[model samples]
Target: MKPVRFQFKLKYLAILALAALLLGNRGFRSLVRNYREYSRLKSEKAQLEQQRVDLEKKLAEISKKPAIEQAARTELGLIRPDETEYRFPAPKESDK
Candidate 1:
């Protein structure tokens, strides 16, 4: 009977160790996943910051008088009162 009792305790200890190992493995996997997500978000933040700077520069340029007039002349097709507009026909593709 004493031998049987020792065998039972040993089995229980083995099961406990296995359970601890499985739980630790799961926790380690979660840590690795979180670290990858953190790195991805950090890089995305840098890309967004660069885009924001580029947009700010564009905004500053568009706010200027020359840029506004250029947009009006090209996009809106407006010309000065003293200026005459000319339209040229496209050359034939065969000419190229």
Candidate 2:
């Protein structure tokens, strides 16, 4: 009777240990997943910050007189005071 009681206690302890191990493993996997997401977000934040800096520099440059004039001339097709504007016709497909 004592031997049977010992065996029952041992079995219960084994099951409890296995449950604890499974819970710990799940918690560890969750920690690893969170860490990987943190690393990805950190890298993305750096990239976005660099982009913001570049855009700010571009905005500063475009706010100036020369960059604004150049943008106007090229993008908006605004000519200088003494210049004559010319528009050429599109070529046919055979021209290619």
Candidate 3:
């Protein structure tokens, strides 16, 4: 009877230890989740960095004298040295 009681106590202790072991590693799942998130953010950072580089190159080109003059002349309707500038008033709601 004593041997049976000792065996029962051992089994209970083993079960308790197993439960503790499982509970002690609760952060493992979160660690894996955070690692995945970190990788995704790193990839996004790289893509954005590349886009920034591309935009900087484009900005450099646009800042050149010829490109600036062309853009101003075409998009903003700027006049050259010999051209006459014209001003037109916006139509009001009453005119419509």
Candidate with the greatest TM-score versus the true structure = 1
Clash counts per candidate, in order, are 0, 0, 0
Q: Give the per-residue lDDT of model 3 (tens digit) for 1-96.
A: 579989999999999998887667768767878999999999999999999999999999999999999999889988889989887999999999
How does each model score on TM-score?
0.66, 0.63, 0.57
Could you give me the TM-score of model 1 versus the true structure? 0.66
How high is the CA lDDT of each candidate model? 0.95, 0.95, 0.92
Estimate the overall C-alpha local distance difference test score of candidate 1: 0.95
Per-residue lDDT of 52 in model 3: 100
TM-score of 2: 0.63
Instruction: For candidate 1, give the lDDT of residue 46.
Output: 100
Better of 1 and 2 by TM-score: 1
lDDT of 1 by residue, 23-91 (tens): 779787798899999999999999999999999999999999999999999999999999999999899
- Which residue pairs in candidate 1 have backbone atoms (N, alpha carbon, C) closer than 3 angstroms, thus clashing? none
Evaluate model 3: give its TM-score: 0.57
Error of 2 at 75 (Å): 1.1
